[model samples]
Target: MDALGFSENLRVLRKNKGFTQKDLSDKIGVALSTVAMWETGSRRPGYKTAQRVADTLDVSIDKLLQDEALSGGEYLSENELYSRITPKTRNANHDLLEIREVLRTRPEMKMLFSVSKGATKSDIERAVAIIEALKKDRG
Candidate 1:
């Protein structure tokens, strides 16, 4: 198993689920320090323990253990995506929330055509501005 990948994935998943280390430990009946160690890749859990953690996180064991650089493609979790698009400034999350709303309303609309895989922050912001402009015109 890719310990580093697992740790990063676990951190992302835990945050997305709005669980602090203490909360996750409580859910999985583990110590808070255990969760911290897992997130740091300092320790590995047994198979049964890993399965329990996976189940608690509502993710498969494979997802928890797989390296991100699979043959299919690189896996970018939601947190990774956010970090790529915006570096967690105060307004970045608000911008992302608005962009997510646009995406929800227009799922078929592709933002960046040429570069579909790893879009930069400016690319997303530019696309969103265009979309919002068009929306304003229509309204």
Candidate 2:
């Protein structure tokens, strides 16, 4: 039963498991600061690491990362994401979840924001493909 959001749950679970932040980070293959951020609620884990955290803590994903704010429109809208980015494009129901996750994983290539104006869903798909390829290449 998770009464708190992801951060507090992570902290309590880690301590109960007798794992220091450093130890937990080592097991989950993330920087120690990343674990710190998770505990402090400064950041949330993308799909890449959420399951790893849940498994290490012996908790289900629903129990580990469940948060009220997440259910209350944590995801930004296209207008919010592209307001300063490119307002002319507006929004045509562009589900940017995958793109956002990709960008969160790769901050260096944020220039993709430039494509928001007049960017169709097809354009988004193409950008994801390109970025995924880049991810594989770098790995």
Candidate 3:
């Protein structure tokens, strides 16, 4: 896991979720400077803090630790994967490639894709809403 890669990933994921560093700091119960340091690659959080960041960003720890060497590859972190999986991304032309990459990397979601295949648009909407509700409940 590259520290720079981790920092970059954190920054991108936070921005994607429409959160500023201060908002993330507040939510993760960390100092604003601490978040800044982490994002700047000047510091790294402990396991607990890392977990908190991951949970807040709705991503797995592994996503935050992606190898920098693979940055140019087709690999998409869980954060990017979920972003592309969202309904809003469904209409984006680039999202189709992302969705395919996600399915290739995360076999578990294959069932989700298959189940939603023949379903109405409303069914997908309801499912997404349920998932969002579940996330809120967990948080």
Candidate 4:
């Protein structure tokens, strides 16, 4: 969104909450001119103040930054998707290794041992392909 768009959005939210610029400034512990500058598109709040405004407005920081529908909805940008998935995927991979270790000593997996113990060429190729895809998709 443009600066003017951001300004308008802030003003609308403040008005909807029945707050004057001074009232919002007081609530967020900012100077009145800071709020005025934001509303007039002459300046923007710093990250800290932006966060406070989002909290005070009962909105997410992402929503306050961008007024696009996707910003408020389920869609994530490529960078956002990567940032969100990286740690989660790494943790899950660690858990999977632990499961593999546990299964190595489990009698219940004996019947499936032959299939798992001897990897076919196709199985190896598929695993490589999956790894390549994951690497390619990571941003």
Return the top candidate by TM-score: 3
* Models ranked on TM-score: 3, 1, 4, 2
**Per-prediction TM-score:** 0.50, 0.45, 0.51, 0.48
lDDT of 4 by residue, 1-139 (tens): 4566567778877887889999999999989998999989999888888889989988766556664433233555768745755687779879989878867878666545555568888986886798699999994
- lDDT tens string, model 2, 16-128? 78999999999999999999988887788886588898899887665576553333336546455445444433342244666777678876656557556679999888988
lDDT per residue for candidate 1 within 1-139, as digits (tens), equals 6788888878888887789999999998989999999989998788899888889889977677767723345777867645544346538768878877877777564444435557788878887799899999999
The residue ranges of model 1 lying beyond 4 angstroms of the native Cα positions read 69-73, 76-139
Tell me the whole-model lDDT of each prediction, alpha carbons only.
0.78, 0.73, 0.84, 0.77
Q: Tell me the tens digit of each residue's lDDT in model 3 across 15-134.
A: 988999999999999999999999899999998889899999999777776655223556866677667465765567477888898898898898899888999999999999999999
Better model by lDDT: candidate 1 vs candidate 2: 1
Worst 10 residues of 3 by lDDT: 65-74
Model 4 clashing-pair count: 0
Please list all clashing residue pairs in model 3, or write none if there are none: none
Residue pairs of candidate 2 with colliding backbone atoms: none
